[model samples]
Target chain A: MERVLDMTIQEVRELLRKKEISSVELTGFYLERIKKYDGSLLTYLRVTEEEALEMARDADRRIGQGEDGPLLGIPLGIKDIFCTKGIETTCASRILEGFVPPYDATVIKKLKDRSFVHLGRLNMDEFAMGSSTENSAFQTTKNPWDLSRIPGGSSGGSASAVAAGLCAAALGTDTGGSIRQPASLCGAVGMKPTYGRVSRYGLIAFASSLDQVGPLTRSVSDCAVVMNAIAGYDPMDSTSIPQPVPDYTELLGRDIKGMKIGIPREYFIEGMDEDVKRAVRESLAVFEHQGASLVDISLPHTEYAVATYYVICTAEASSNLARYDGVKYGLRIDGKDIIDMYKKTRSKGFGKEVKRRIILGTYVLSSGYYDAYYRKAGKVRTLMRRDFDEAFKACDIIVTAVSPTTAFKTGEKIDDPLTMYLSDIFTIPMNLAGLPAMSVPCGFDGSGLPIGLQIIGRPLDEGRIMQAGYVIERERAVKKIPDTLR
Target chain B: MKITKDVVEYVAHLGRLELEHDEVELYTTQLDRILDYVDALNKLDTEGIEPTSHAVPLDSVMREDEVRDSIGVDSSIRNAPERKETFFKVPPIIEVEE
Candidate 1:
């Protein structure tokens, strides 16, 4: 055995095709890894061993019958934000601690139908609120690279699981920078498709218009394979685009000669960590060497992105999360009156961060202040979009550093919420523009923590983004295994 | 841009979350700091700009008014805290005091 844990999705599929590995054996191998190593990593909240084994057996049977899909028998770690039928989808919150959704998210259904084995549900920030898994109510997931450090989140568990080789790939939901930030911190490839590219049915809403689901995998090709399976219109999700799905793998290995890649000048400013800037610059050099042109473009509204994102996202989150009152579902408390019950249940059920956002959102969206704060923020959002529109007109794709620095120590900024919020400063703009973005490992910091390069694309143009990411991910040759894991 | 403890409590009430006295003071200071940072937007020249909600251009995507089977009210409300005869139960609004 060549250590199946080190193999990529493509290699695993190749092994399965040659009968060198059965799906059952592969699933068993990963499940054993999770059982053995996940105690320290805390990557998974629930492990469906029986379900995964049964699905793997079925995949072997399907392969025997000459019907193997791209993801056939592949094990995936699912973020708990997606609803899985008859399984607990907690979104890592106490309100729904024991609640099992009666339905499956569209992505889960698609993967299940294709015979992809389910490894388990990964942990996340409560309602996908924080950038670190430290906010998860059940337990905090540590970065596999350094147990003393934090895994960037709210998709931290998904990123860590794939990085640590607990699963071949994982699914994650990104509202702002949940997927990309975590992926960058953990040395994994995470993609957030253009808005409406993937169905949102059964995904618990964080900020309705901003939330999107995508993949966190070991490689860009694996991301494309998963996207192909999950990116299609679902009648259940009204926001899903009704466009024809493209063959993402078809564009792989394409030449990038004479392609224009824009490096936004505003992104590499004074505050960026020197090491991260150097890594990104070196990655850009590789692109230029590969016959691609790098143009300097300016998104003037870049400085305003974090502020715009928080106001708009918080305003929406306040409204969207209001559905969790005691009346419908989740936790409910006995009170003297309806108002008391609502207040008590919410107070006891929600965490400090969730409560803070709700309050801020409510204040912004209130009747008297709507025009001043909420509406004004919305206007700024339009200008932010216009900035990207102008930038894209000059370049085919935009590249930037995913985070200012690599993974930090576990308790570095947990007490200071604003410091934690700055972790996604570079990534919030893409969500504001509803553009496709991806993160790939570029290099490592002095302490050996991995750094990532982010590539952003035009709206609904994920094919080109992945194609470009594939080019860099291969050429960079930055496969850094964490010291803690090794 | 200074958020007072009173403002935090008021906002908490609007959000339907109850906070303790100590938390009220703590969050008041924290939210004030965040609000001050974000208050930079007040300086932007968005005088004639229209507020944009959705990023992509979209028109009405309404569906036909055809009757289909419901998602089953029973299953939907299966997890409700208080129910009575297949309907969710909540406290009555108006009190009749004699």
Candidate 2:
């Protein structure tokens, strides 16, 4: 059982198939780890121990009957943003504290169909809003590497749990840098697929246009397995493209003998940490050594990304979050009248960051400022996407630092919203362009926090991104269980 | 160009959000700074460029107008914080002005 914790998803599948271990025993091992480590990590919002065992039992029975699924019998963590049927799915926000979904999110359903076992719901920034997990109204998730520092968010718990070996892998959402940043900071591999690759049918809307569900896992190949399960066209999400899904794993072990890698000039500018820059530059050098020549590319519209994302995402959030009126699902506070009720419920239920975004969104979309702020941001989004489209013509993929720095200490940037939003500059451009990007662990910073190499691919070209990421993971990544866990 | 308290209050009202007085003051300064940061977009000329509402181009998705199984009222109202006989209960929508 202890050895199983160190194995990748494929290794565990081999063990499970050869009758070497039952799903029940494997899940129990993970449960014990969670029981022991979660107290210090605070990674889980809720651990559905009984249901996990029951699911594992079901998987065992199916395996006994000769059923083989890609994620069969494997236990995984779920970020709270993905709704689980009859389970309390709080996007780490108080507003939805007691809300239980009537149906599973499409991604959740896909994983369930594959006989995957659910470990529990992981913590995140409220409504996937903050860069650090401190914004969760529940408890702040501690970094598995260094407990005092934050696990990057809003997928903080997912990354931390995977790094700590609490679960084989975890599902996370990336609206901005939520998935990749945390994965980078926690020494895990996280991908934010193309915007419409996965179905958004039951995902709680943040920035509807930008919100995407991806995987955070222990290995790059594991990321591919999860992506294969979840990435598909769903008519349920009208915005979902009709492109045929490719086997993401096929690109692994792929040779990039003559591939062109792009290094955007804007991403390497001032204010980036020396260690992070060094790791990224070294990663490009590795690609060059493998016969992948590096091109000096420019995504000149990079600077406007953070600002445009704020305008766009907040506006969409303000609109999507409007459904959280006191009368309907979620928390409701009584007031003298209906309008007063709405004000009280939202004001009290939402966290500070959520409230701030709602107001900013409202102000931007307000009558007089509509053309100046919201509309202008929209046009700038076009320019940003065009910047990528042009850059992609020059190279197969783009590489950059996942975040300017590794994980900062808890409460470092919570109070200062401006400074906090700027740290997201590196990750926001991908969201705006609606391209697939991933963060594969490149190296550890001087302080031992993990550094991630951001790989950007053409729209719907997650295969190539994984190809490069697999190379980086194989050659450079130093993923290991932190000593704290040992 | 500054985001004044009144503007924040009005926008908050429109968003159906109520902020404490201190929150209003704090958001006023923060929102001002954020809006100021985004003010850089004003310098670029976007006269003919089209706005991208969705990154992937989308068209109206026409589906067959057919009845199908949907979540029943019982399940739909299961999460209502305040419910009255399958209806989400709320405070009175109409009240006489004081």
Candidate 3:
């Protein structure tokens, strides 16, 4: 029999329903795997072993009472960015080191209602700031595929845990490729739902307009199962749409014939690694073979995406993060007076990357430079969105490389911030456009590092990407178990 | 956008962050490069384009003005660094005359 840790959510759900395996047994099985492996990967900031077992026990009782939900007893990892009432939710920054939110994030509330087991907070880049997990205030999370390489961030820990089966699946937030980039690097499936598709009420703000919560799992189907539970409108989030939610799993395994997949010419530009290009191209070929037409399209504003993203994201971040003063929740370093207290608390609390972003954000929004910096970037952002509007007119979904290369060594680009930012060049545009995109394991490089292929769909059209990702996953049939775990 | 040390200090102050000398020096160079790189936005002619603060055009998000149950005082103050019986405590905002 396959190890319970390796099974998908559906497999576990079936086992629980049949009474062959209890929810506590399943939870204990994953807790053992996490205990045995998490120390080496640094995937979890804290493992809620007792909480998970307790939740599992409750789920088993519910099962006995004939209550069966899709995620009734599944164990899942949550990125530290979400506020889980009474549980530490740090965003992996020292400022929020001990913050136990007064309320659960909408997604957490929904999942808890369905009786999902919380496996504890996953580590991330401080304030969800960097491409690599190196920016985390705590320890760095290593890629399960290659221990020396990094798990991509700021959802790095979530991706790492799912890739190594430390948790059956995990929830991750993506502002700009945080979910997809790391999932690609770690050989797991990650999704970024449309903006406001999932509520942002209690999620730590990174780029409010672009920030979204999604899932990282071992298979595309598991991503759909998670989506059904988390995606919907919430009165708490003003930005959430009032559209009716659909069962995303209904679209899976359906024929994708005649589906037009757009291939943006800009994404295949120079400097993309040779192995990455070949792997993505090979994956593209699989779609063509399966009757989907590939249309070459252009997002002419691709080059401006990263620059615009940094400007707007930082500007919003500056405004959003201003509330972390010492008087309120979280860490405090006493100073002589109120002003000094604010300065001391923030300076000592935030990591270097968080500080840099705050400073840059403040500069753009500062009096002298607002027009030339922030406004100009916003106008260019409109153009970037239009580029997708025009491209989608020609195609239903877009296919692109998730990152320029596979995972890099831990300390490789931490010193060179621009180089590190460029690592997410291909994945940033989708977020700027506020679309739903996903990363699926395409293939492995010669060094055994995993590569990710991004599938982007129209706004609120997560179903298409999920459908397409499912086909590619089945066709490739790639079983990726990281060396460390094996 | 030349990010000088003085400018770094000014921005840090605006961000309410206290930085040491090395931080100012390091950030000046790093911010300079980042600002210079983003200057490419100047190349495009945004003559009449409207700026987009958000990707989706959300209408006014209004809710009913009715009182509802909140987390309440105790839960709200649970994570406060320093708090009194029912409120967060902060350094005195107004200095009393000596």
The C-alpha RMSD of each candidate to the native structure, in angstroms, is 1.5, 1.3, 1.1
Residue-level lDDT tens digits of model 3 in A375-425? 999899899999999999999999999999899999999998988988889
Arranged by DockQ with the best first, the candidates are 3, 2, 1
lDDT of 2 by residue, A229-284 (tens): 99998988998888899888898998899899999999976888899999998998
Between candidates 1 and 3, the one scoring higher on DockQ is 3
lDDT of 2: 0.92
Which clashing pairs does model 2 show? none
Chain A TM-score, structure 3: 0.99
Ranking according to lDDT, highest score first: 2, 3, 1
Off by over 4 Å in 3: none
True contacts kept of each: 0.81, 0.92, 0.90
**Cα-based TM-score, every candidate:** 0.97, 0.98, 0.99
Poorest stretch of ten by lDDT in candidate 3 chain B: B54-63
